[model samples]
Target: MIARTKIKPVLYHVVAVLLGFVMIYPLLWMIMSSFKPSNEIFANAGTLLPKKFYPSNYTTGFRGFGGISFSTFFKNSFIISGLSTAGSVFSSACIAYGLSRLRFKGRKIWFVMMLLTMMLPFQIIMIPQYIIFNRAGWIGTILPLVVPAYFGGGFFIFLIMQFIYGIPKDLDEAAKIDGCSFYGIFGRVILPLIVPALITSAIFAFMWKWDDFLASLLYLNNPSNYTVSLALKMFSDPSTQSDWGAMFAMATLSILPILLIFIFCQKYLVEGISTEGLKG
Candidate 1:
């Protein structure tokens, strides 16, 4: 058993090292390719490392979109993502608190309905949703992408509800005994205990909004309104040519923020996932 356990750790470390290379290889490729000239991109594709790294591709990528700058796209992405994430996190937390910590009629039915929505694919309602937004004159703008976030999303709701459930009911009851209202308990007691939950929900919400491609493509018609994901589109031109180096550079830039967010919030994410039933 001791030998088996010792070998297990060795095997795990070996597997982890292999997986790390697999995960990081694409990023290293992107960084290297971004430095290569457009011609060298395909020619040196097999090479793991570039002979010389040039910073010009980043400059070219920033200047790629006609008159529209990378900064504009960055700002638009930031606004849309920030608005949607805040709306989703706050509304989801409130819903989760109500569902998990409070007793109410039809609660189970409501939860079932919420879960049912998660099972439904976006494809099912895409066309109808597009039409509705179009008629409301919300399409070709950021509103369509940001507004639905206010209606707590199904996955986020479930995520926060699970965290809220993990919090002891006795804590809430104790707060009540001290003459606290629902809002007071949520604000003073449960809220403090669920920092892990909030961080988890925020991270998920930010990631979802950050990497969102379809919704941005659907609603943002104008080039000026593009997100970082859409920056890759500009790297292609059927009439003239596509710049692979520039495209790869932009892709690398788009990946970094999401990676950093995960790095910062990973601790909270793991903590939030640990299941502990309410004590009441």
Candidate 2:
């Protein structure tokens, strides 16, 4: 029985490692190919190491197109992502707090509507949203992308609601006895306790906005206003030659911020998700 138990765990670990390698192979290949020359990238595709480590891909990619540096794309992504994340986190927290703690008429209806929205795919609302934004003259701007976050994202609100539900009711009662209003209790009692959930929300919000290609493509027509997604596209042209090496190099660089955020906030993310599921 002891031998079987040890062998089972060993087999499980080996299988897990193999799966991990398989999942990460594409990313590893891209990173390795970024160091190869454009012409050599395809030729040496099967190999993990480059024969000649060409550093020009980074420089060439950063040079960008039409007089705009790749830095502009990175900057725009940061601005859109930062504001959107802040708005989503704050609005979601506020809305979730109300939904979880405050008693009001038709609150259940609102909650149901919110969950229903989650089931509704973005494709269903894309055309109407485009027309609305076009009428508002925000089609060529980032406002349409960032402003909606302030309204509270359905998934984020739900996640935060679950987290809020996990908090003890005793804290709210104690705050009430101490003459705390709803806002006061929220700010003083609940806010500090829900840091993990907030960080999880922020991490997800930032990563999603950072990687968003469809919305960026729809709203941002000007090359100067393009985000990283658009800039990456510029590196390839089916009608002509493509800069695959530079594209891979920039793509590698683009993932660093997300990787760093995940590394630092992973602990909170896991705790928040697990606790929310268990307690809620």
Candidate 3:
């Protein structure tokens, strides 16, 4: 039995290591290929280590396309993503607090409708949304992409609502006895305790907005207004050919913020959906 237990753990770890390699192989290839000379990319595709790295991929990506600069793309990405996250998190927290805590007529119906809205796919509404925004003169502006964050996005609302529901009602009752209003209880009491859920919501929102290509493409026509994802598309070409090396480098760069977000919030993302499922 002792021997079997030891052998099982060793086997498990070996399997885990193999799976890890499989998962990371693409990213490793992308990073290494970013260093290779454009000619050798296809020839030496099998190797984990590139034979020669044209470090200029990094340099060229920054100024590779005319004088456009990667910095401009980075700036647009950060601005849109940061504001959207802030707007989503704050608005979602506030709305979720009310939905999960407050007592009012027709609240059940409203909650059910919120869940129904989530079930609806964005594809179904895209045309109508585009038309509405276009008529409002928001087509070429960042407004369409950024403004919706204030209304509390569906997913974030649901996430924060789960966190709010997990919070014990006794705490709110106690706060009420201590002369706290519902708003105060939400702000000072409930908000402080659900930092994990808040961070989780914020991280998800940031990622959603940052990596978004469709909305950015649809809303912003000018190359100067492009987000990193839209800008990244500039790397692809038919004639002179897309520099896979620089493209991979920029791809890696694009995912960095998302990776950082998960690394930072993962410590608190420990709680699961069960915590959110409970109701008082």
Top candidate on TM-score is: 2
Each model's lDDT comes to 0.85, 0.92, 0.84
**lDDT tens digits by residue: candidate 1, 1-280:** 8999899999999999999999989888888898888888888788977778877888988885779878788888899989999999888888988988767899999999999989998888889999999999998899999899999989888987887777777887899999999999999987787788777878888888888888888888999889988768778788997898888888888888888988988989887766343544
Residues 4-52, candidate 3: write the lDDT tens digits.
9899999999999999999999988888888887778888889878876
For residue 170, model 1's alpha carbon misses the true position, in angstroms, by 1.9
34 in model 2: Cα distance from truth in Å? Answer: 0.5
Among the numbered candidates, top lDDT falls to 2
Candidate 1: TM-score? 0.92
List all candidate RMSDs to the true structure: 2.3, 1.8, 2.1
Better of 1 and 2 by lDDT: 2
Give TM-scores for every candidate, taking all chains together and pairing residue i with residue i: 0.92, 0.95, 0.93
Question: What lDDT is reached at residue 235 by model 2?
Answer: 97
